[model samples]
Target chain A: MLIFEPHIHMFSRITDDYERLALAGVRGVLEPAFWLGQNRTSVGTFVDYFETLIGWERHRAQQFGIHHFCTMGLNPREANDDRVNKDVLAILPRYCEKDSCVGVGEIGLDDQTKTEEKFMAEQLELAKRHDLPVLVHTPHRDKKKGFERCIAIVKEQNFPMQKLLLDHGNEETIKITRDLGCWSGFSIYPNTKMDPARMVAIVLEYGVERFVINSAADWGVSDPMMVPRTVVKLEQAGVPRSKIEQLVWKNPIGFFAQSGRISEQMLQQPARANLRETFDGNSVLRGQDPDRV
Target chain B: MSRMHEQLATLLGPAAAGADAEFAKVLADRSHLPVVFPGLPRRLGRNHLGGGRTRVGDATIDLDAFRPCDLAAADLLIRCEASDDELFDLYQHGDIEERTMLLRALHVLPVGPITVRMFGEAQRTNMLVHVEAALCDGDLFARTVGQPGFEPDVANRVLLKLAFLDLPLARCLFAERHANPGLSTMLQDLATEREAAGRAVWRDTWRMIGLAPTAGSAARLVGGLEHGDDGVRAAAAEGLLALGRKDLFAFAEERLPREPRADIRAILQRCLA
Candidate 1:
């Protein structure tokens, strides 16, 4: 089955993950710009990270036969940093206009702080101005309140609900998100987020219309293969092959393709994976001889 | 019980009859919707299922299993039964997901001045999904700008939005059909604005220049050769070469030796070669 991981932090993953993802039948990945674990003191670091997502990260993914697309945004966690938030917001438009940069995302409330809300609203405007979809990152703690705040902010901004992806959803949030008419995203992490069985149950109930499952895998203990693993679970649970395909592949392409960059044809085209590919002087095979591996 | 379930059940028809009541109850409960029937007791592990297994009950079966055929039939049913006014109302009020489905159904839905106006409004929102729903297939573009075509102002606005959104020109429905001097001028203006603001101009913007080459565009590309960023210079050289403007070849040849970066030099060398 051709899979499209709508959300994953491939930057935080090793090259072997890409190979493994390709082997697992993941054809495309949308890497939304997210907060690094450590607080960034400067906007330059954010710029470098965004550049890598669209440039180096895209190239690296292609070397493993995966088409890489990304969403550019000031992640909510960093929006609280007053020093660099403005600069990050200022430069966001430039990145958003890149071909591989598809949407404004991984942006929304983290702690539900006023600072986070302010940046979230501003980035919603950015998405509006750029004609991009939004991938909202709901707060882990006080999630119900966070999801409410997100819906409120989105309504206040008059951002189209159809253009919003209420990500990191759970049992409590899925029905509400579906009713609200926005896409619901679940991160199938090893722990913390919903697991595969839970995701399968959500899809079973929701009917997989605007639902997308992802491995919001990052530096934290996460699994990049969670999406495919979830697919396996869904199948075992007796979900039809077509529904599983829709949840994993069609749903994401339908969402991110709003950028006009992704399409079924584009996904079908096999990417050439040259393990010899290098970024700057760094190769994926650095320190290891390909012949031996 | 909900309007949504009613619509879904109506769309599913006889295929849904067996599980319709159970599906409705599942929708109604919201809470305590079982992942597995109580007697089944499938040992749900993280990311996968483990030991304890039992028969999957009809009540516990994924309702989405009936989706593919239901959705296709629903689209057809909507097309045949829904009026333009009905479609417009639904589109205007539908949630993002519903609106997206409506937009995708545009092909079967009617296309006229009213629908065209609706699509134009969606494009204006600059919301990726809405615009994509309206434009991804290039049908709206074809109808608006390719057929009898929109007024020049409307056409120019659509082209500029496509470029501004950084959408691939190839995916655009009538990019070639609507290519005009006015569109080229708009692209050049955008490039000028980016250069003045010290912002990186989109590569597609350069492509627009190559598509509609001008003396001004060539000069701008030549100036790009002297730009500080190696990528800019290389892109400039590549654009010029792609345009096949031999007049700029000499300029590139002259800059080749002075070009500090090997990558840029290689691009310049290819231009001369």
Candidate 2:
């Protein structure tokens, strides 16, 4: 009955009230590193953010007994800045560890800018380098071009399609990307992104394999509880419990836990409060031992 | 009297007018040209093509202008001398490009008799099919609507309309719409407000795309750099550069000296540069 939120930005949100989500049955989460509000300017800025993802954020979630994981990348907007872009890209390799790090993600396209295209190519290289799964960001505008370009560049680089998770996928983009054999994701926002109702429709149409949903809630009006709400919605819609489990739990664990960041044994360990835990030491709930959490 | 002749004279500059489809066939026969699908859409201008086209100063030619040739699997490629519009015609006719700019220009051409080749991941092989221009546009357009931030109405109004107009005229029209004494200043304030409110990424893009040129936008951008978060600082740098304020270069430079993060320092350098 433990479900995982494969994508969310817990730090971007004030999830003080998310303990209710635990009561509802969410057991783990994977927060892909993404642009917070606008874009991050410096490598140091990204480092701090990345640290929070692997550190404090993970700890914060554990207070309620939820396991936390994250993926890192040079987001599209930040990729536009050549100065910080290279620096960030350079650091991505180091952080994309199988332990603690889940995959290379939230990288793809934004604005469909030439700069974005260039960075997209480079980040794909980084993904290949780390042998980690890639989380791509399809641009909000000119999505056809962005999606087309994303496919084109990946094919050009000869990266394995199975390792790519094209995030922000909607009906059209998901169909195409999934057809191309890349994992697909839909972000559930209140209005701007996908909703649980629509997510059900997509799963019904696309048949749920290589498909997942996320909150992507960060620095905006987002629902941290949306993940479990989606599970509830799926149940109400007549989707089989097995199917729901695969989408919310097994799939994410397969993709992320394979990175060697977390093992079945590690994930099952009970939560413990420790003295050294801080935003710097651990991101989960304060004083929780990550080994047990 | 042939379409090739008529199109060639205009596209390839009168000198290429006499070239016929036989020449295209000959070239296709001799070169290791990839197969071209002729059923894709073309562009709206002289470079109008089905797939892609090649340009000759003042004139463009279609791949059909050359003689068709036989080729091997590895030699599978398509080359066309055509306008953007005409090349789109070739694409609609079932042509594809494996070479750079071999098919240039064609964007909005109607689908005709020829079939186009599409590569499918499932088969991992090229599949030939005929798709009409309108259908291609519709397909791509529909897919775009599902993307994160595509607003066809807004994109059409802003990018499409402005495509034909000069920058100055576009700016004037922008000014007239707001009806404020300090239209530039007002727009800048609006952009700042939007950014501060934690607006969705798409909303911010549409609002700021036009106003990035205003002095007010630049001022706010400069002011935004000092905000607490790195995301804000990065966005401010981007906005300042978009505003074309060279003066901000010095300001950016000054901050870089004190910046502790390697990535932030790099962004500041690019902005200043």
TM-score of each: 0.52, 0.48
Query: Can you write out model 1's per-residue Cα lDDT over B1-273, one digit (the tens) per residue?
Result: 144345434444554443343334335543212211110111111111222211121111122222323233233333234456655654543333344545644533435555566666665665555666566543446555533336766767766766666666555544555655566678788878977988666555554565566548888777878878665676677767777878778988889889998987887788778
Model 1 misplaced regions, further than 4 Å? A287-293, B1-273
What tens digits encode model 2's per-residue C-alpha lDDT throughout B118-155?
Answer: 10110121111111121122122222232334333322
DockQ of candidate 2 compared with the true complex:
0.01
Scored by TM against the true chain B, the candidates give 0.57, 0.30
Instruction: Provide per-model DockQ scores.
Output: 0.01, 0.01
Off by over 4 Å in 2: A15-18, A263-265, A269-293, B1-273
Q: How high is the TM-score of chain A in each model?
A: 0.96, 0.88
- Give the candidate number with the greatest lDDT: 1
Candidate 1, pairs of clashing residues: A131-B126, A162-B96
Question: What's the i-RMS for candidate 1 in angstroms?
Answer: 19.7
- lDDT score, residue A159, model 1? 96
TM-score of model 2 relative to the true fold? 0.48
Candidate 2 interface CA RMSD, Å: 23.7
